[model samples]
Target: MKGLTDRQQEILDLIKSNLENNGLPPTRADIARTLGFKSPNAAEQHLRAIEKKGFISILAGASRGIILNTEEALGIPVIGLVAAGGPILAQENIEKRIPQAHNILSNKIDYYLRVKGDSMVDVGIYENDLIGVNKKNPIKVGSIVIARIGEEVTVKTLESISSNQVVLKAENSEYSNIEINPEKDEIVFEGTCVGLLRDFS
Candidate 1:
């Protein structure tokens, strides 16, 4: 909480707002573009200052990587399932965030959603699991992600079979693979699964 100036606070506000709106933190370039900085380095400097103050942490080697200390804020909406094939926030897409973890809920969570299927069981995510998703797109291969195929919201392991072909494969044999031809099917990635919350109690 030290080393941050008023200007840095403004930058933090802007960054927080952007995260709320997009479900992902902004990049150095994005910050620069938004604040009218001459270069991304300027934004980087401010971000470093913010990190030093314990307001955020920058994930090294990751693009647009920034995670706020959630304990400092509250009421981060938990985004549930996204309507596959449409905007992520569509009414049919979002669920509700029930307060569970004080450490997690205290921090600004953009949203929370529950896993409705077992397609990701191979990865240890199961049905009714609460997942924290950052609002963004273009997830990497092998990363567990949430995708929309049409009106249905599904949690699956994302695999890129080809440049234009994506395979949403299930972790269990009981389910089948969903092959998506970007040129044919309206497939869209809502975000990558960052963390999982299961209520064992």
Candidate 2:
């Protein structure tokens, strides 16, 4: 009750309800979806605000790991500015945490990616928007993804031409499709974009 608004209080109650009935805390996605938020990042940001007010604690990188009491699991790791040539879930890259994210996803989100460029604007994804990612999701023919090549992390639609030949297509015609040769290129599929967040303010 220190500094939480009514909405935050509702969120805290929601977590408690989910934990009590389902034996786990509500995830950022659950919170966002239930609260009618367009993005899970809204829930994440609210949780951060609540955490700052000393209502909860996050155990970064594991699921259902919010330290509400002594009956929680590990947590979800929220990464900061991704380095050019680094693994996506590297410990050093984590900036914060989400307690857990369940419900409605076979492959749960591994992290939240802040969109950096306009290569996918034709698809309605904008620069500075937050994109939710599931690193383990299998890529499809027209999947929008966040990937890493050398020191650059890019978001694009994935198209596999063969077992080892892949093309990264941008939504904008100004940018050409990037052809990948795994034998010659150090390429890593970071994750698929599952959600997006942006600040109107």
Candidate 3:
């Protein structure tokens, strides 16, 4: 209801109509066809933008996880294991959209990275834990970051950064710190960790 564009309001109305008529939310394809979008991806883009504006919450990992006007829950995308050299946020890598309550973490999370190794266990991150990440946050030394080394992605603490070199530190004693020379290696910072979620069940 704030500053939604005409098209956005149209989509929102469509969602409401679908829920009222069919007792379920419309799929991305449904929105695409109704809105004359070329593809479902375009619909998804608009949905995410609306979610950022706090109109709805998108539950990742579900075909229909859109919740209307959720004030207590925020839908955060869940990322599974990334393929080598693939974009970190590629749609295929998203396992599901899960709802995280607003008071769970202070930072505004962009996504949740599913942990795969014990290298960060000393800091409490373990295998299968979903770590919330904020891609917009400024990174500094000691911040735990999601980093891409060549095609591989890993979560480690930012030990240090120099003009020519950068160091990534592992929390576990068994793993050695990763040292890279920026001039020779390709490294990209995806995001910094904000909080974590682990399913004990």
Candidate 4:
């Protein structure tokens, strides 16, 4: 992670600042203009170096592909645990509830659920990120939600629901879709993911 010159550090700083302010990184053209580079190639070179050092990831062909390897600090509640399998801290399992600062959303968030797996990474909700959940049901079909199945709690996208079955989809295909029969099992929608907080350690 060393070997980055001062100019490269400045580029990294610019990217970080942009993410904090705009929720996304700047484009190559933006960097080139800000740094007084005559051509976008200069910005691209720095970006490649940063990516090589493993501090940032450059998404090929993406308009805004810069993603900081580490994120800024955000104060959020560290809930006990939500199982990726047959485990979710059922209401009865919660023994401690500490208030946390919400950097993304300020109102109506009931609790924060710390993500624990790669099941939702394709959508940029990585492991250890805190998702702001609201008990209020989302009025749309594609809402990302926190759901409870029996005793396990999982975060998934609500793909579709019917009188016969509820389909909970994972953004990452590695995790199979969760299909529940409303008649056979009790699948409860705890809350919708209103905000994403990627405050890394």
Q: Which stretches of candidate 1 lie over 4 Å from their true place?
A: 1-74, 80-86, 90-95, 98-109
* Model 3 lDDT per residue over 126-163, tens place: 99999999999998999999999999999999999997
Best by TM-score: 3
Which structure is stronger by TM-score: 3 or 4? 3
Worst 10 residues of 2 by lDDT: 65-74
Residue-wise lDDT of candidate 4 within 103-152, one digit each (tens)? 54665666677887889998999988877777775635798988888877
Candidate 4 has its poorest 10 consecutive residues by lDDT at 70-79
Expressed as tens digits, the lDDT of each residue in 1-201 for candidate 2 is 366899988888888788778988887889999999999999988888888887788768877556563212345666657865657777787777766657644557777677778999999988877677887778777989887888888899986656678899999989999998888887877778877657798
Give the clash count for each candidate. Answer: 12, 7, 6, 0
Q: Which 10 consecutive residues of model 1 have the lowest summed lDDT?
A: 100-109
- Report lDDT (CA) for all predictions: 0.74, 0.78, 0.88, 0.78
**Residue 142 CA error for candidate 1 (Å)?**
0.8
Clash pairs, candidate 3, are 59-97, 60-96, 60-97, 60-98, 61-96, 61-97
